[model samples]
Target: MASGLCENCSQLRELTAHLRKVCREFERKIRNVFREFSECNCVRITPERSFLRTTQELPSLRLLNDDETQLLSQESLQALNKLAVSENTGLQMSAAMHYLHLSHLLKSPLPDAFMEPVMALLLSTDLDVQKTISLALVNLLVKNNVCKELVIEMGMLVPILELFQSGDSAAQCHSCACVAMLASSESNKDAIVVDGIIPLLALAKSYDPRVQQNATWALLHLTQSDGSTRILCQAGAIPVLVLLLQSSDSEVQFCSCTALCNIAAIREHHPKLLSIGGHYLLKSLLTLMLSSVQKNSAQACRCLQTLSKNVLIQEQLMELDCVLPLKALLKTSAAVWTEPAVTLLSALSAHPPNNDFLVSEGLLDEVALLLHHHRSSSAIITHSCVIITNLCSSRMGQQAVMESLCLSGLLGALLSPGLSDETLLHVTSCLNHLTTWSEWPGHPLNLSAAITAEQVSGLVKMSGQIQNSLLSCNCAAIISKLEMTEEIIGLLRPHYITMSEYLLVFLKKKDVKFQHLGIVTIFNLKKDGDFSSLLADSELEVELRKVHAQTEETRRLLQMIQPLSPSSVNP
Candidate 1:
């Protein structure tokens, strides 16, 4: 038994040695092929034949048969395992490239063993090899948190940032992408920032569009962290990103818009961005916001949302004629587009001056329609309510909102099920502003839409049903306003001053009421003979003398008393 065990050990060692030899020979042949390809200027190698390319284009992963996929995965991992540990530089580069290419094809995360050698290869001095490795790392780190953790743990940020700082544009692009992917993992964000990735990416954004796009993406990711946004702004990333907003590449435009969005998210950066040609950026984004492309338009709207937070920027945007385009977007049937448009309009409306533009552009009706159409979507409802609430800030906007039939929409929103607390706040606040118009002494809106007696009674009933305090208060106020209207007073005249037994008993005991009744009768003597006759036998002289003695009380009472004029008594 001992002899047999020894023989088995010997065979195992022999098998290991044999496998190593095979890998070495295969590595040699692949290196020769790469050398030959590089040497020939006219040799055009399509990706279909082999992964090698003069342009270093990204590898396309084809679907493999189930059984074949498993076989290839196992064999390729084994080859990579050998090639990764090889001392030869060519072998290491090829292994990294293979890892990059195969990662897209694999169904699972790359094994832990593959990280050490690939990370080590990032230290190579050869520019071509460094570019290849950077590309490999970029592909590996994308949305792959495990790989990102590994990369972070290996302390690869400095090397990666250095590559981006000094390498060619292509290398810098890949390095920026890798760094951005690393920042995608929340745990690694601070580490990447600490390693000075922000300034490097800010500078790299000045390169060609591709590099600028990736750098912008990295800056965008980094800015998501606390304080990193200000760091990016301080590093002067906003102007470069703003400049890229006009790039013909949709990706460049998308990334640049999103980055500036992040910068503008910080209220402190608002002025800085505006001072650095943000108006031009706003113009480009406003134009792109209505683009047919969903991503381009969506990103543009998001950026506008950030820019609109600045009251000054909002004014600037209006000056650029952004209102019309935004109005057009507000009219889109797509909720995806309408949501941000509504959000922006809501922001702009906070400044009273823009309220005029919003009204002049006829935007309230579109917002009102959005509220009714997307009643089921909480986000849409919230945004629409906020817009209406802001639009109510100015008299002109309020008039426009009332004319747009948004008052009913707001009422419906107040009763909507599943309405968020924010939506409820805005809805109640909007109603408060709209109903308060009656409180405005001489405003046309005060008497423009008189509430009927039935509506006033209904609102009183609604006040009882409403559990929200703001809502109940506004409803009660509406009822009070309606009761004060001439039409409502006429309809409710019999009820307002009914001569019930309870009132008669109460008035007899209260001397102040008796005096008030006497003064009121005297004032109505010319307006109605019957009212004067009714009080003639009540000792009007005595009550009038009492009212005259309490001068202050009499003056206040006289102000409260109104004669039974024909307009009120007959209506």
Candidate 2:
């Protein structure tokens, strides 16, 4: 019995040893499967037995429960780290693609460890892999300034630009998009411009509009730098951007117009932009503004405003008949469109020639209506006031304003309580121009009917209420011209020097009639010592002698003169 029991114990021990060996072999097999699968190039693992095997199938794939998921969660980072550094090209490519996809899953930037491997993989020979990496880089860089700086710091600009220049459309699109994202950072702008990406961007703009849109947007971002405008212009960007303005796509048109608008902001580019058919750009913007898309119209108007800063361009815009379309835009019930529209008109009207054109187009009435309709919006009122002020500079403009019955609106704006000081100042100046028109020859407007005691009273109140010296001076000058009553004299007496300085400024203006009005207003003040001093300054006497010497007002000034008190005279 004892022998039989011992033999049973021995067999039990042998069974335990055999089970342990089988368990070790099974664990080793599963470990090899995972190792080989992670290193394999195939996107999906089919239970392959070897790390290098491209294709194979194995049975008994089990569904993963919570336990398996927990295990994967713990090992996923480690596995990715290993895959990133793997020597196999296939595995490295897979790692790059995975990291890009995983970038979406992670909330922050790819670990500092991962960036080097991924960026290094950018030179992958496979076009598909290259595109994938480019696309991945775009996702990483989008709205992520940290990643952008990293990419920029890693010297990715050349590869990205090469992709923009030579890659397929998809590659170029993704690459250009990356460039756009990076270019948004103020820190990245110099790096981009220094690397000479402007020509590549200009080249990319000629591609499909999709690619063109991205590249154009990049160019737009570059222009934010103070110096990029010259860079882009030198790279032949003006014609390309101007041509893009004609695109039918609203977004394309909007982006293109904004880019051109930015470039045109640099005063030096004005002539270059114009010489490249900027007038057609104005026409296209006019056409685009007709679209229901407000942004398109707004951008177009802004571009026109910038380009119109050049007086020659303003005249060109006039010659292109931009007034009618701009007028139509003013008719829009939308104030969003009205501000830029009127603002552009204001810019165009800055040039005296365009002011006459605007008057001829009946823009005075439109501007008056704008003032009347948009009394609540200070921006509209301010721009409209600028138009009125600029318009009233010319005889044609002044007549148009009076004939269109905008005089009442101008007076009302001045009288209206709580108007912006800027608007009030402009309105008052416009009124002064209207009332003084009778003094200038070839001025046919009869402002006598427009002027009234109540209007003069309103001017008095504005002069006292506003603290601006120029505004008060303008009010006093208008009153002195229209109705030199005791109250007007009191207002003018204290502001004699202010008025003199005002007159001196306009006296220097190229407008002869403006100088005539100043001389007349000052002479009408009848401060004989002041009048004599004006005649005494040799330089002033020379300029006054040139043109104002013959006017009736000059004769009146000469008549009012008396010798200065020796005490008040400069030694």
Candidate 3:
């Protein structure tokens, strides 16, 4: 046995081996097991063969079979690379085969000098050279990440992607594998999508199942790009991927589902998916969403969550009786699908038919149970609040929510410090809908009847906070959304001076919702007599006219203010 140099750094370092051979019961040949070694130390254990440029004959690299011997010095690799690209067909074939053989024996990547020759051989018109090199490339790419980066850094990606259109099954199969390996890196995804996506889509219909499988896997990684969905769909990805979602091969179907998961996760892409696969994609995702396999079901649930945000999607889901599965998933205690399922229901519950069906199915109790179990997850809490908010839009939904035990946690999240700003925004918005809401006399059962005047004062003060504008704006918007009942006005009376400033400052801003909220809230608060005279002040009059010019609601309010003259002239 010969001592070996470290294949990676090509350094002459010391590494101890505990080698033993044992014969199987019926075999004369013995098997040797190699245990993993820890670290390499520079103890000058052995001398390496130096690079030689002599005119002597090259060693017989063809007949070598010693798997444990390190035959690749930097010099031998350079010599083989030169011969691999030679114009003579016989020399090129032998050198390419020797390089492929060396890839199996050496545990390290081929040096930087091997990249150009290997790339040239890959793009060669010869079938044997292309086939052999593709295998060797896949092996190197799997064992060494240095090779993956080298493939991209050397500008070999555009040429390598060209292999997908080669019209050769062997070339296409190995090419798909190589592209998927390259795309597994986060940094490599965008570059691959830039040049490789069109040719990549065609392989999904390859006569070879292996080619179809690897191509879909490549798309799975490529679609991980944040902005890749539009380019992929416009390149005819939806039709091909949707067909693969129904593939006889489970792996192909899984990969296709995952790629679609990435695509559908972008809400804007749903319409394109709908336009192409429409009912087919919708039903396929629904079936996978309820799959017995955990991974398939989880991914499909995420896709359906974003797709459900579309109105047509929601209508289709309702006709499929999606509420029953959603109800079952919500009550499964804790599931990978629970949070997204809640979000999907939140979208569905916004529609009238879905809301009515959800009420009839008694899903409110399941939602309340989910809140009790997963209350610690801010996402789940936030989505649950959205569902409650959507459900409140209907009379039956409001009745169920008001009668259930979910209100305490829903309202308690308002003051809970652990809740995120997003959760707080949805929580407060949900509270507004659940409370004494009215546009023109809404149902008046106020769960927010529990909000005290002190809490109102704190919320009113929060509206003036400059930091967390989302929170401040929401705080003011909710107060404005509330129907200013006598008790509500009485709560505003104590904070009238501060409350007036909030309303006036809001009127000077551009958001029409805030402007409307300020006017509606002020209109009810002016019954306090002090606020009425404040409304008659000249400064208040100018702010009023500015508001009047911005929206029609302000015009109606101006007419009713006795001291302020109504004017429609543009301010």
Per-candidate RMSD, Å: 15.1, 15.5, 11.5
Cα lDDT listed for each candidate: 0.64, 0.68, 0.70
Candidate 2 lDDT: 0.68
Tens-digit lDDT track of model 2 for 1-571: 4445577798998899999999999978986896676576673454222422321121111112223232224344444444445555665566565655554544554556556656666765556666777887777777362467778888878877777656488878878888889988888888888765655456445648778778878888888877776777787877777787777666777777888888877888877776745456667777877777878877788888877766766766777777776787898887888888888887877777666767888888888888777766777777877888788777567667766757766765665667777777777777776666655555445544455556656665555442475676677567556545455455445555544555565567675655655677656655545445644764555666665545667689887999688888966
Better of 2 and 3 by TM-score: 2
Residue 117 lDDT, candidate 3, scale 0-100: 75
TM-score of each: 0.62, 0.65, 0.60
Could you tell me the TM-score of candidate 1? 0.62
Candidate 1, residues 212-244, lDDT tens digits: the string is: 767777777877876766666776777777777
Model 1 misplacement above 4 A:
1-82, 85-90, 105-111, 124-136, 143-147, 162-170, 194-209, 379-395, 411-417, 432-467, 475-571
Candidate 3, residues 133-216, lDDT tens digits: the string is 777788778778246777888776765677777788887888898899999887777788788888888888776889999999
Scored against the true structure, residue 439 in model 2 reaches a CA lDDT of: 53
